[model samples]
Target: MDATDGRLEAATVRARVATRENIARMNRSERAASALWPVPLAFGLAAILVARVTAVIDSRDALGIRGEFLIRDPDTALQLASVVASGMLVFLGIVFSTTLVAIQLAGSQYSPRAVRIFLRLRLTKVALGVFVATFVFAVAVLGEIRTKSGSDFTPTASLTVLVLLMVATVVTFLVFASGTARLLRIQYLVERIADEARPVFRDAFTRAQEVQADRPAPATATRVCTNRSPGVLDAVDVADLADAAAAAEGWIDVVAPVGGYVATGAPLAVVHGGGGGGGGDDRDGDQDVAIRRCFLLSNERTMLEDPAFGLRQLVDVAIRGLSPAVNDPTTAVQVIDRITDLLGGIADRPDPPEWYVDAAGTARVRMRGDTFDDLLRLGYVEIIRYGAGAPQVVRRLHAAFGSLSALGDARHHASIAAMGALLDAAVADAMPAPFSDLSGHPDPRGLG
Candidate 1:
């Protein structure tokens, strides 16, 4: 009995650790910065190795003839390599400056959260890495050129490699320029955010299906756990929460929903079955710690785990377009189209489950899951509210609802009809007598 109890305790600890690590990975800055470090380190190491190998080869008189290679004279080779290194360093500086400016522009013009899309681009990281690597390799090779016995000795292989790197640097620069230009466009930004959000929606849908099949009875609250700090509830490791709850012979109902700002001392979750031990007992304390470990709180919202974050970003863009200063109804309409595409993808899928169960067939965790109605409201209602005064905006919104209603799914139709009705009432109240007729039906072209 002692050994069995020890093994169970060890397993619980492991589960808790894994849950914490998973939460840490949801941080965008941490993930992007991690990708940046490895590039410079790997390239710096490669530079040293290439320099050493070329020096060894040069010592053995490996070059058949000095003039056979493009760079013949040792002095000229060193001079040219140094120039290339300087140019690459300057180019790298320019790239970093331009990228910073672009990030600033994106943050100011679009939603600040949209900046992560640029930060996470693999192409930009690789471009930065290639230029830095070339510069390092050129400098290393330049250091190895030597003079001995009235003869100049140059490493032909090293110079050749440097020339290739220079060519690669140029190619990468052009590609990076084009990519940066594309990133600035609103269409690309909307599509990219939507693409990233699709998987999150699918995962939530899958989990819901699993929970629905083996639905367990909700447990009555035995204890409530309060948070220690204030932040947005970004994500929760539900599986790990279930593991910990099972170990405590109980279940946890997560009180704070994802994307919600939680304050310190507020009930984050309620433990459902542990014998009323409050916070003092060792077993109860362990359960409290385990439950807290599963909740990932952050100062800002992230798309990694919050299914609604992407929709929020799209809404931000649309609302910004409709602002009085901007007065760009077409931009708002474009955003609605993208939102329509995303909603259409998940329209027919079943809603995610609110409860999580353990291997023992006991319900262990209760979470807030995404529903079609919730998504529809998040994606469209705000835009409708803000753009109600603009006929074009109102018309485009009606068209979006019509498109979704056309799907023929009863669940989707119900939400779409309700939103359309609300939009019609808003337009009637906001638009003047002359334009009230525009709200009669969804015109795909928005009064054009």
Candidate 2:
């Protein structure tokens, strides 16, 4: 391959790796497992090493006068260690079962997406690790106890370590219980989701100086890249797509929006001006594959690439609260408060550029990203539609719009005013009696 071709190939490889890493990082289950599983494994191995070393030292009388620090009876030490290990194993089972039950209950009682918050909790993972580690430590020490005529030995140091582990496990269990209780509160869940989503919104919408204005692709574009798998378009590696387009001397117009689903054979991206070739040709075929790799498809939406997914989660909670089965208007109002904060953050930032340009100042890729208006709609419209009959929900939503409008962005004001009109209409239609009082007025405090 020529130097230019080699450069493009290298760039594509880097892009592919980065894309996979991004997806893995966004996957909550994979992240939790990666972080939580190694704790027990490492602890188990460490326990065995410590046990063997302590056994050797005790047998050799290496401590000499310090032998007084060792537990006097090997048999008693072994029995106690075994009991602690077995008891810890049982406790580990209980903690695991309780955590799973909590997750299941949270999923059923609240939005399923909110369950990710629990999965990502650090305290729970640490508590689990401590329990497993304590059990492993005790078992390892127990194995070192020898009762033979000439081989009787006590792993004094190992026993000491086991005692420490037991204490740590107890403390961790208490903290875990307390944290879980706090997490179960609805207010905590709402705040947690908002906290996680704020930085994502900022990152997704942050303007890049290198991004050029979007240029329309040529009408004669013959090469259309289709998705081979059907799933949500989680993210697009725009830089990689741009590199590939630059290499092929073409521009790629992204057809599918981020967070939207694309079916197999649907147009994922349209490549303009890359000369057409038969399917078997390596040059065109490789370029097609390169472009396809830039679009990361997944079974579900992720906050890493789709800021709207966060809004969707919050909205789901609100809508569920508004449902006839759970008419918790207070919860719905709290959700709106968070939604307003997210929307306000979006309104304050400049729109992220849709077009990516290569170093030569040519636009190589066009991406489909969510706009502030799109977020506004996603954040409020569904909740309003579901809660139209509830005066409290309507009032809170009106106050949210007023707060968003106060940010002084004309576009934001316009979107909020339009939504306010819709809510007014919906409320009038749903509860005609309240229409006279709730009509078109900006209530910053919502009926206070």
Candidate 3:
């Protein structure tokens, strides 16, 4: 019974690993970097396998130059391999422990989401993978010396490769450390988050088109509720949903906003007009399955296509910097610089298409996105409210709003103006009279 259960567990693990659908957003390459084991595990297996194959060549008498290199004695060769393997294992333990300490300190000092920056670094992952591979290869080589034709075989080529891997791992560790140190700094952390969304905001920018606002879902509308896997609505494939609805001769409104929390059995979307004989219902559960597949939910939101997440993280850092305990207004000021540039770039873009339509010009899908006002609010609301007491923060907000009003289309002026009013009021109410008056003037330097 125990053996059967173990086999079943093993089979389940394999199936989960092989199936992409089990985890949403697995198609994204960045997602792979977050997992610590997979890369290192693959490297370890490949390294050992390469060493084993090379051993076969080393054993061949036809290769006249094989045994004429490195240690000829099996015991000395085994000892060297053992030492390298053990040393590498110890080295990996120390490196990861130090990394966790860094991550912990960064999270406490900055925002919690800052930890993802470290985990998502492929450089660190690759370096760790090389370390693991070096260790595994050495160990595997050591085993060959002990078990295979004892005292007779010494795979010199395999040992040389192991030594090379060790040297490479050492170099990789230095690079990883330097990169990690840079990422830990507040300026780098916020800028990176801001940079990830620059292209998103720029590319998605567009002139406001004829947006067909969402109509209320009728009582008769078919509600599409989520199945067991509950998480944040990270992303929705708008094109696919539009296509599915068009095919079904129906309309879909994804009620839950991307980046919002979704509970199990909660409404994922509402469908109107379809499925008596349409919308993939030729088979049971087809329409629902199609609808569910278009949504990629996970424990947290990703910036894959969501530009607002960038604003979200930046605002978080700025707000934390404003907190009394971490009252580092300079960090808040730096954050505003990024917010201004990001919003400025977005201000130049035309409005995105609000409605996803089919060939016949019918509205097939309705979903919400952050407008300039929305982005402005998400990026600045808290900063203004919290930073009001600080003249530097208030001054920066004044400048940011002024820049946006100047750089963006006339349509964005109203929103920018409203935010400016809020900033004006916040400073007037929070700061001393003279400082409040001075802070109102646009100063990109926040103090200047």
Candidate 4:
């Protein structure tokens, strides 16, 4: 049965990989967005360069600069010289930008919206502004030249060419700037929405993944594991579950594997990974059995849904579950990821017409899925029940209270006390049955 169960668990776990893969695919969209800034940047630099070279040529002739000269008037020469200098600066700026972009895209950390921000500075427009201003100033100088000599300077084909170039540069600049700004605004709005709703989505993804793993597979057998020790049931702690999850590889999400007492023979911990000989070793058959049974029993026993605990232990567990492996504790990235997942599930709960309120003054108990109850039973939840009277008490409370942003604003003990009052007396009075009562004493069972 143990072997059969392990195989079944393995197969059940296989089913979830596809969903996980899908989410991963979504991540690619994010990467594509981050990669989109270089286009505008390239155009802006090219325009700046053209304007610079024209200015430098005109400057040399007017200022008596030694370099090869073309335009005769001081003003015309200076404007052309200025354009050349500006172009060189613009070229350097682009090179620097390219390097920075390469670094950021290599890791793909920034979101698409953030990339849009980088592109929306209106650099092209700014460049156009300078060109327009310079051209207007040149026209004034041309008027002065004609007034002093009482003769008009005929506009040559070269002057006409220069004017056309300037017009083209400004127009291109505005077009690029307008497009980038519009795109950036859209991306920013999307990002804000994603941020607001991220917790809920993340939790859903993780939960769905877990369900897919636990689903039954006829090819393998399954068993329940319980902590049957006579004395205190030193069952695995929440810390252990977190530790196991954290210790696993990034792609291989670890979840509680089984439920019930070690049912004579059960696997406690299960590993979800690419089965192509790339998975971690179980160490030994005994260790594998013990770990698998422990996970099953723990998840089965724990109760994770309790409104009173929505801001407390439940949130803590949710954060821990989604958190990165303990080895990567330098950042809270994983915790944030898991929090997003937890919130998503809470938000998506179907609307309930009535809130459950028991005599204990605690919210009424609304049952969640069997998996939630099974986990609660495994000692995973200190208290498990729905917030009756308000089906979405947690969500509502968070909305009113401003979420974790001001979670500390409310009195912690006060909420706990109120919760204690809400628990149904009858259920509260019931004591947990001893492990020994369920399974006969110390026979040859090796679980202990």
TM-score of 3: 0.84
Question: lDDT by residue for model 3 over 1-448, one digit each (tens)?
Answer: 1245345222111000001132354436546767777888899889978987878777774456666766777788888888998888887987798679877976888888777777776777787889899888898888677435644777777776877887898898888888878887889888888878887786456443343333323335464645447888777776677777877667787788877888877778877767642233234366777778888877777776578888888888899999999999989999999999998987865555545655444567767677777888999999989999998888778888888988998988888899888887888788999877777777788785
Question: What is candidate 1's lDDT per residue for 1-448, written digit by digit as tens?
Answer: 1245345222121011112237766665545553555666677677778778877776675765445687777888888888998998898898888788888988878778788888777777888888888888888887777755576777787887788988999999999999988988988888888888888777665533252223333356478888877998878887788888777777677898888888987888887776543564334476777788888887777765677988998889888888888787777887888888888777776676566666655566777767889999999888888888888778878888887877646767877889988888888888997787856667776767
- List residue ranges in candidate 3 displaced over 4 A: 1-30, 61-63, 67-73, 146-152, 206-228, 275-286, 359-361
Task: Tell me the TM-score of each prediction against the true structure.
Answer: 0.87, 0.86, 0.84, 0.27
lDDT of 3: 0.75
TM-score: model 4 vs. ground truth: 0.27
**Per-residue alpha-carbon lDDT of candidate 2 for residues 244-360, written as tens digits (9 for 90 to 100):** 888888888899988889998788887887765326333447778888778778776667678888899999999889989988878888888898988888787656666667656
- Indicate whether candidate 2 or candidate 3 has the larger TM-score: 2
In angstroms, the error of model 2 at 349 is: 2.3
Q: Who is ahead in lDDT, 1 or 2?
A: 1
Task: Sort the predicted structures by TM-score, highest score first.
Answer: 1, 2, 3, 4
- Each prediction's RMSD over C-alphas, in Å, is 7.1, 6.7, 11.6, 20.3
The lDDT values for all models are 0.76, 0.75, 0.75, 0.32
Worst 10 residues of 1 by lDDT: 9-18
- Global lDDT of model 2: 0.75
| Index of the highest-lDDT prediction | 1
Measured on C-alpha atoms, candidate 1 has an lDDT of 0.76
Candidate 4 lDDT by residue in tens digits, 322-428: 23342222112222233333433433232221112222222211112222222122211222232211112222222322332233223232432333344333123
